[model samples]
Target: EEVTEGEEVERKEHLKTQWARLEAVVGTKARITLIARDLVKHFENRLAALDGKAMVVCMSRRICVELYHEIAKLRPAWAAEADGEGRMKIVMTGSATDPLDWQPHIRNKLRREALAQRFRDPGNPFQIAIVRDMWLTGFDAPSLHTLYVDKPMRGHGLMQAIARVNRVFKD
Candidate 1:
């Protein structure tokens, strides 16, 4: 059956409305807080005994920062003001031009490399890494046992992100 031009337009409009609604729901502060609380609960109750690290893949840089703060609030000991002192860290790349709140997570190449090295170590306190797009591909952390994806990813991107936790690691 052929779709009339009027029907096609109607369908497009309906899709646009749906997309807007989804964006509204997803961009709310309450939803972010809820997700943060649930993530902390999952980590403490489920992923704690795995003796491995976890990565959280967020939809955007802003969400990454917000979620990180929310999680930090729930688990104060998991957060630190300095990069060298955090159990949970945001590992996204950003610039000085970005918001001042993001400056701590925005590191130079050497700092990023240091963070990467720490993340690769199974015994390091740096366990949870909140990221937008940096370590999704061409990065390997065998000790990474859990991946919490809050972003919409598909095709090769999705596969690579999931593969972050698929590495072989000894108990």
Candidate 2:
């Protein structure tokens, strides 16, 4: 049955209110720091044993970068000044016009391709990748066993994101 315009407006207003509440809680620095610590603990206790890699799907590019830094603070070895040398890296595309702080995490096409190659290698030190949207589809790494989703996703996009960890790896 077709709904009235009033219902559509009500639904939109409800969704906006929900999103605002979610952002208020999740976007806080304290919450992000707690999440970062939990992620590190989870990695150490579980994924590290299997020699597995993980992906962190964040709400946005800004959150992706913030979470990367928070995680890095807990594990300095995971952070690298150079794009090509980090164990934990953010894979997002951005232009020079974007915020200066975000520039380091942003990469050109070739650099992203290189990061993709490094991530595909099971033996490589590159283990955890933080991303907003780039690798949610058309990317595969068999050794990846965990997906830490801090973002809200649904339907096809959600399916594709979770499927990143579903590829068959060795026994």
Candidate 3:
């Protein structure tokens, strides 16, 4: 569908006019820094209420790294600088050959499975997981009660993402 300037204008005006008649849904367009801030706040609140973990889905690895740093700043205990033992949060993305200083947590398939297991474990404090395209589907975590989506997802992909938290747990 080639949308001309005039047609685009008309479409926008029509949508604007019908805005009140239709339910409005605001999508994500915020800066990564700001989104990270809100994500932490949501996690803190959910922890208090449900005592569960949270997952953050980003559009790209770059944004995932950016959000990880931002959230790390707010929650020092989750940052790599906090301790040598481990961090509370982990970034799970596809492995890269040329390693970057910011993405120490990027893992291979086997290691990714390990991290996914840790995230699923209730005993572990690995609370928040930041991902680009990994773990949105076929990964089960019953303790994960919160998901902050910073990317657009639809259809089966969206359903699978929601299924991550829609598991039955004894807790």
Candidate 4:
């Protein structure tokens, strides 16, 4: 069932309208932004007490970027230069054509692996990672004490994500 260009545009506009209505019924962007700011502050205190890192899982790449920027505004220390050293970073899969892809943190296998390694190192500056769907499995970070999940998950996916914070780190 191939649709005409006009039909596709109509469908997209319909979806956008529906999405806007849904957002109004559930939560507004301003409310979410305020909560994200508070969540960063809350987690900062908790993570500091535990002497551990954290991972924040978002539902979409767009939300990941949005939350990162919001939190960065509150905690300027968490904002890292795309090419320089920083403790906080966003990890999401993106292709070369994706305009939102950060040059230093583009989501390739090699870059993902490198970021994971840094996240796992307690002495390293990379303390927090914001992710959408990456590092849900086979990635280990014993020092990761908390996982803030803004996205929904169930069954195996849910279990694997929970396991991320269950590892024991020798202090």
**Top model number, lDDT:** 2
lDDT of 2 at 89: 93
Write the residue-wise lDDT of candidate 4 on 47-109 in tens digits: 667788888887666667767777777778878765236768888777776664344456567
Better of 2 and 3 by TM-score: 2
Give the poorly placed runs of model 4, Cα more than 4 Å off. 1-28, 100-105
Q: Give the worst 10-residue stretch by lDDT in candidate 2.
A: 1-10
Q: Model 4, 99: alpha-carbon shift in Å?
A: 3.7
The C-alpha local distance difference test score for the whole of candidate 2 amounts to 0.85
Per-residue lDDT, model 2, residue 55, is 93
Q: Let me know the TM-score candidate 4 reaches against the reference structure.
A: 0.77
With candidate 1 superimposed using the best TM-score fit, by how many Å does residue 162's alpha carbon deviate from the native? 1.0
Instruction: After superposing candidate 3 on the true structure, give the runs of residues whose Cα lies further than 4 Å from its correct spot.
Output: 1-30, 81-90, 94-99
Alpha carbon lDDT of each predicted model: 0.84, 0.85, 0.67, 0.74
TM-score of each: 0.84, 0.86, 0.73, 0.77
Q: Kindly indicate the candidate among 1 and 3 with the higher TM-score.
A: 1
Clashes of each: 0, 0, 0, 0
Per-residue lDDT tens digits for candidate 2, residues 1-171, read 011223677787777777667766787899899999999999988864688899998876778888888998999999996866879999998989988889988888999999999999999889999998888898999888999998778777888988898867887
Residue lDDT tens for model 3, 37-133 = 7777877887777777888887656567767777777887677533223445455655466458545766557766777777778877778887766
lDDT of 2 at 94: 90
lDDT of 3: 0.67
